[model samples]
Target: MGRILDQPYDVNLQVTAVLSKLSLLPHPHLHEYLLDPYISLAPGCRSLFSVIVRVVGDLMLRIHRIPEFTPKLLLVRKRLLGLEPEGINIDHVTLLEGVIVLEEFCKELAAIAFVKYHAAASSSP
Candidate 1:
């Protein structure tokens, strides 16, 4: 999963991702990471989270990000409701929260991987 982000994109990785659902840590892992504890998490958020995470990570560094997904999602909702982009107002703080979620996710995942690597290395002598 970490490798997917670090490496350049490829179809092979895409296929493998679909086939394995990223091996337990599927796309919903990121969604759940982004959402509040009141929200539900599942493996069904691949497409949305893929774009959201990319956009959030691309726009800001992890340390200073706010990962609120609602406002961005509201844009899509507006279009679906046959409304123009500017027809609706956005919650700036909520939007920032969504971006922050993505940044926190990267930090948390990296820390977990770092600890895992160390545990394995230490056990190996």
Candidate 2:
């Protein structure tokens, strides 16, 4: 999301590109937007629901490299995988929660990354 690269934080094209890909995918599952973008919109069509959860889970695990980000990321991945507090009984509702977690992490990471970027820039020149 743009949150990761916005002001106060140095914009990293590579990071922004990754987050952008993630932002588009979670919308429909999270809401019934004007464009009607729900990935799991097809009722009883479990496949769409499955795919979104898997992809979002995978992306979250892969993108977070910072040491501070690891703990929460792992917990989210576990929940996505249905490893803790229960198993993966993913439905539209659960997927919504998952995306919310992902979005929250994105915001958190953006803030941390931005602060580091600002610090680095200030020292650069």
Number of backbone clashes in candidate 1: 12
Q: After superposition, how far is residue 108 of candidate 2 from its true place, in Å?
A: 1.1
Instruction: Encode model 1's per-residue lDDT on 1-125: one tens digit a residue.
Output: 32232333243235334533332343554435432234444566444345545665655553244344545555644553468555555544333433334444555545554654576579995
Q: Could you give candidate 2's per-residue lDDT for residues 1-125 as a string of tens digits?
A: 22331222223335444544543443543222211224434564443235445566665664453344445445555765678775434323333344444465556545644654576579996
TM per prediction: 0.32, 0.29
In order of listing, the candidates' clash counts read 12, 2
> After aligning candidate 2 to the native by TM-score, how far in Å is the CA of 89 from where it should be?
14
How displaced is residue 117 in candidate 2, in Å? Answer: 0.5
User: Compared to the true structure, candidate 1 yields what TM-score?
Assistant: 0.32
For each candidate in the order shown, give its overall lDDT on alpha carbons.
0.45, 0.44
